[model samples]
Target: MTRRAVFAGWWVVAGAFLCMLTGYAVAYSFAAFFGALESEFGARRGEISLVFSISAFLYFLLGFPAGLIADRTGPRPVVVGGLLLIALGLVAAAQADTLWQVYAGYGLGVGLGIGFSYVPSVAAVQRWFVRRRGTASGIAVAGIGVGTLVGAPVAHWLIAAIGWRHTYLVLAAVAVAGALLSGWLVRPGPERYGLTPDGDPPLPSGASTMPAGLGLGEAVRSGPFWSIYAGALLMSFGLFVPFVHLAPYASDVGLGEGFGVLLIVLLGVGSTVGRFLFASVTGWIGRRLSFALMYVGAAAMLVLWSQSTSAPALVAFALLFGAFYGGFVAIAPSLAADYFGGRALGSVIGALYSGVAFGALLGSPVAGYAYDFFQSYTGAILAGAALCLVSFAITLAMPEPARWLAARRPGP
Candidate 1:
């Protein structure tokens, strides 16, 4: 295809981006709703937090099966189905008269939708490009940054205007429309269209398009896999803490509600820039270094967060934390695909993210409990920073892609 023709893989990236944008916007926007939910239900911080915890746990936990199913079937159907569930869940949450109903509707429905759609959509993008894989993956997942950039503020505004129930209803409508459009844009792998990765050309009648790499079992048994898993698990324990508590912390410290929510907006901005910037630099600095630096930077920012009670300090923490976090998130898929092969890419990614899923389940709620016990966020913030240092240390031990492949390449 000519440069004028535009590659098919970019379209896949676009679709995946939109799917993630919708899913994560809805997912992360829970933070914006945190106060409202607590007020509405007359619940404590730790108890109300379980809603997000349940949602995160389900999506990450279910990602393994959801990915396997997508590997067998096409991602379009899976994404479409997931989006429908998200909309249904939002509608249910809108009508919820109790917290348990909210748990069922928002928690289960949104979680299941994301589980089914996220990994599959991401893996599909990886199949479309090799030369530009890093750039493509970063752009695709940057939807998360964009979504967060847009979703929380929008949700916050809507909540103030109409209240949280109606805000969810609005989000549901957006999710439904985005899902349909994204699913339509989502296509099968390049082979389905007789094209090679990066849209090189039409292949010979049966020219293999699949990249050679380790299968799920082989990948699971590797040291690199476990190391990556452990790193994600530890880093994740504090990852969602800010999303859930930043606003509340600001409130407690005397920053107004508007500014607290704006912190998330700035986070989105930094995250979007980081995704693009880091992806651009990956070819030069290399993935392992990028991965390690992200953790270190995140650790430093979390340390900053523990001390950030002033407006400028809080803003600095948000932007810096978001920049590092965005890079961290944008690189995961490409890193995993680089370590393993794309043979069962979706399932491998699903398995890897299970660590993150478990971490997310505990991250927010544990922070909430910490707040309840300590009456402050300092301990949790510091803990998250310490975990980041450990992640940095562990990831530092990882071998470069060439060495890793040389040492543990899969046999036919």
Candidate 2:
């Protein structure tokens, strides 16, 4: 059978999945090492936590340039380069003896690498299937859930067995292998292979059929874009609060390390389920409503989390909160494509995701300071719930872009 007979988009999705899996595995593993770093570096909670916050900030900040590069040059080179940086970052972090060295190595290095890898990979996959864009994007990003599921527990074990430094070394090797495999599998949009998106038949005129929507400049100036951007920023402020703090919080409330890790795994399970479930229903409910509902659910879960003091209660909160959190993350790229169109999607999506950087940058360190000052997570949890409520309101106000709405009507 000819190569075109088999859809190549699925292969691209697979490559995107592996890249996300490996990249996020390293990113999310930060929580597992939190305590070790604190003990090793003689740092306070806020001080050490800044490492993750700084890394997350750079991860989001660098996405803008990375996406621009991918839009111009394609995704393969970006992913390959990102993977190498991730490996190098880990290697540098593994050799570090000081807090600043750790920040320089793990924080900036991993952040930039993930920033390069993530936006390009997602944008590339979205270009392959218009009809199934939500599902395809959902499936690809579900790797974050899978990575968190496996990475947290593994990191916990590795830290216990061989120490956090060796764990970094091991993860560096994994990143290198993942990068090589991704280089082999990832390709640009279907046009590169002389096929149309979703394997559609060639047009009669043999002209390019890619949809050209709002250019980057127009998208930036539009009201709908700001609404979406605002919502993303607000949502992110609360989105990662738990990821960075829940493990340590569990310990403070007397839960053991094993249970703490289990909480993270449970959150990952919920995230996986939510991503697939919410994405599947977007066709019926529409992207905005689906996203808004998740925000409401997340806010409710955060409220419940703030009141919980027992193990069982925390587990329930972890699962519910994680599901809604994953749903929000899963839908973002599809929402951007829906609102903005495929042309310049990399740049538009990258710019939008910078909100994630600012939010995460503020969230982790702020929450850490709150905990250190008050000796309680109650205030932080309440703040997260409040941010989610604000995000939900903003999301509710967002209308489908005029351009997108115009494109849907029957021709005169």
Candidate 3:
């Protein structure tokens, strides 16, 4: 067979992975820069944390529009545009001398850039696969973990050597290179290539193909969508709190700066493994059960994280939390596609991811404020654990989407 005949969808997966790796490397690497920004600006934790919170909010807030654009046009342009914005955001952030500048540059620019790239890439990947949707999505998102693993330590080293400003400049260059490379590779689904989703042959007589799911409005009005959204929002609340605070918290507990960054590395390791493992298993265990498992695991880990005071304990918390956290990230889009169908998958997934925006907006800064007020992370940790538990309950209570339920019933 010719090279193109071997299922070109995997090429889309590769492009999506590269885009995520580059974009998230810049996005998540903010944790490494968190302390430096605080020191440089003489800002409060809440203030520094707001940079990430704003970026995250815009990233998710814009997902709906980005996805709509992707649905109407295609993913390549969206991905390319996002990469340019990300580069510009980093460059502008590098030049910032004021908090408002940071907000505009990093928060608004980078946030919108990431938002533009994320949903489209994910939704595009969903459209390219059917039976293997879970595994394909998992593999694509594993880039986030890999990016974190590489980006966190590199950011730390660069900051120590050259300072955060230059580091941002360096990341900006990387973003440009990533965009140029991956943009060439990202295309729409199989139809563009004269194939079907998953590259499967035409179905035999009487075999049922899945229907296109609800329209954007119908999806919004559905109970299952909201259930997923609520669960995702709560889960994100628990997830990002530690992500932003873990570095600083390590320093507070006397683990030293090196250990603080090490925590991020460990989290990345666990996250990468979890995304691949948990999502791959969905073919066997199913999406709902897999999601519930991740929620419960994350909640349990957060409890452990709350009590952690030592290096080993924190390390354990990082691994467990990262695993479940990564699993949830990998599974969310797939779950949305499973319920909503691929017709309007971009818009549906984008709207659902807005939950992430709300969660991050509420979680990180509030945790920072709690720390500032009480001079302790105890309350923040407990709050995160509570959010995780709430998410767990919500996930359990979620019913199958109406489409899926209807599909399972016997036809006359």
Candidate 4:
């Protein structure tokens, strides 16, 4: 790649980070808004959660279509439009007073926006880097950490000061600026620049070709694909419970609410470090090993949550668990790339990501129901821990893809 191509590549990565910041600021920032929504809207916990759940569902449900759209159209405009919709959702949310309005803003508006942006950003990033794809993707998606660290605190402050309505307005402003910038920075792939995905030359003569892209039918038939899919589902099952419950759980145990928000920031710190660390290591350790470690380590961290009552203990739990969570964000996309070629990477990964959405659809409610039934988060934590163990096993079962093996074979 020329210096110009290299610069363009980094610019695209930067755009992915920006897109992630917007998406995650909305996704991860939900915790801070939960309490306010319950109080201001007179909705039950389940009802309030249903709004966000619907949003998560729509995001995952729409991932396949969005990926198809990105493949057929391009990444830049899709991302830009999605950010605009997110901004509109926030603005509409700022005006919401009824349950239906809340549903509209939180569920429909944000859900559709996330559908447009998140997967395309990753697909675009993967198309840019080949040799160091893991590292590149990690850095690109690390915007989740930045959003958590910065957006969580700002969200808390905004909620306290102007109330949730104006907070949405502020987020809307940020989203619009981000969308405008992303429109300029991002483009489809190296293909537009007369290069292939990963900047590789055309296939060499007599290279064995596996089926290029697996449809959902073919994907379901493959053992390795199902393994990766199952792992993602398990990861999501546990992923949001800690975050969604962290504030209320802390307050229930007599810790300050502010500390609950601070714990999120702490989690973000761990996430920032974890993304870089895991990305760097995946290139050395390889994908399967790194994925297996992430799940096993996450399970250990989830179990540690049962020991948390004090602020310090909880903080420790968050740090460790947060790293594992961020590690998944880094590795999962690369895992998709490894198992499937880059050909239908967007749609295939989108389908896999739907499994995550399904888990999220179940996770928070189960935790909430468990808390309501048992009057503690203990049962939920244990369940999540068990799910992490299951994910570890599934990841461990993944076979090395035939392509990676074929690439290593000696040629005549």
Better of 3 and 4 by TM-score: 3
Query: How do the predictions measure up, each by TM-score?
Result: 0.96, 0.96, 0.95, 0.91
RMSD of 2: 2.0
Off by over 4 Å in 1: 1-3, 202-210, 409-412
- What residue pairs clash in candidate 4, if any at all? none
Where does candidate 3 clash, by residue pair? none
Q: Single out the weakest 10-residue window by summed lDDT for candidate 2.
A: 400-409
Q: Which stretches of candidate 4 lie over 4 Å from their true place?
A: 1-5, 196-220, 402-412
Off by over 4 Å in 3: 1-4, 202-210, 401-403, 407-412
Provide the overall lDDT of each model, using Cα atoms, as 2-decimal numbers: 0.88, 0.87, 0.86, 0.80
TM-score of 1: 0.96
Candidate 1, residue 270: how far the Cα is off, in Å = 1.3
- Candidate 3, residue 188: the lDDT equals 91
Task: Report the C-alpha lDDT of model 3 over 182-256, residue by residue, as the tens digit.
Answer: 788788977665567787764564232445767899888877789888888877776787778899999998988
Candidate 2 lDDT over 1-412, as tens digits, reads 6554567888888898899889988888888999999999999888877898988998888888998999999999999899889999999999998999999999988998999998999899888988888888999999888888888889999999999999999999999998988767778988777877777886886644567767889889876788888888887887888888889889988997678888888888888888899998888989988988888899899889889879999999999888998898899889888888888888898999898899889888888998899898788878878888888898888875554558655799
Q: Candidate 4's residue-wise lDDT over 1-412, tens digit each?
A: 6453454667888999989887778777777887888788776666766677778877877787788889778888889998888889889988987978988887788888888888988888887776768878998889887877777788999999999999999998888998988778878877567655554564565332323545555665677777888888887777777777787777788997788888888788888888888888887878888988998888888888877898789999888888888888888888887777667777877888888888878788777777767788787788888888898888777666655446545898
Q: How many residue pairs clash in each candidate?
A: 0, 0, 0, 0
TM-score winner between candidates 2 and 3: 2
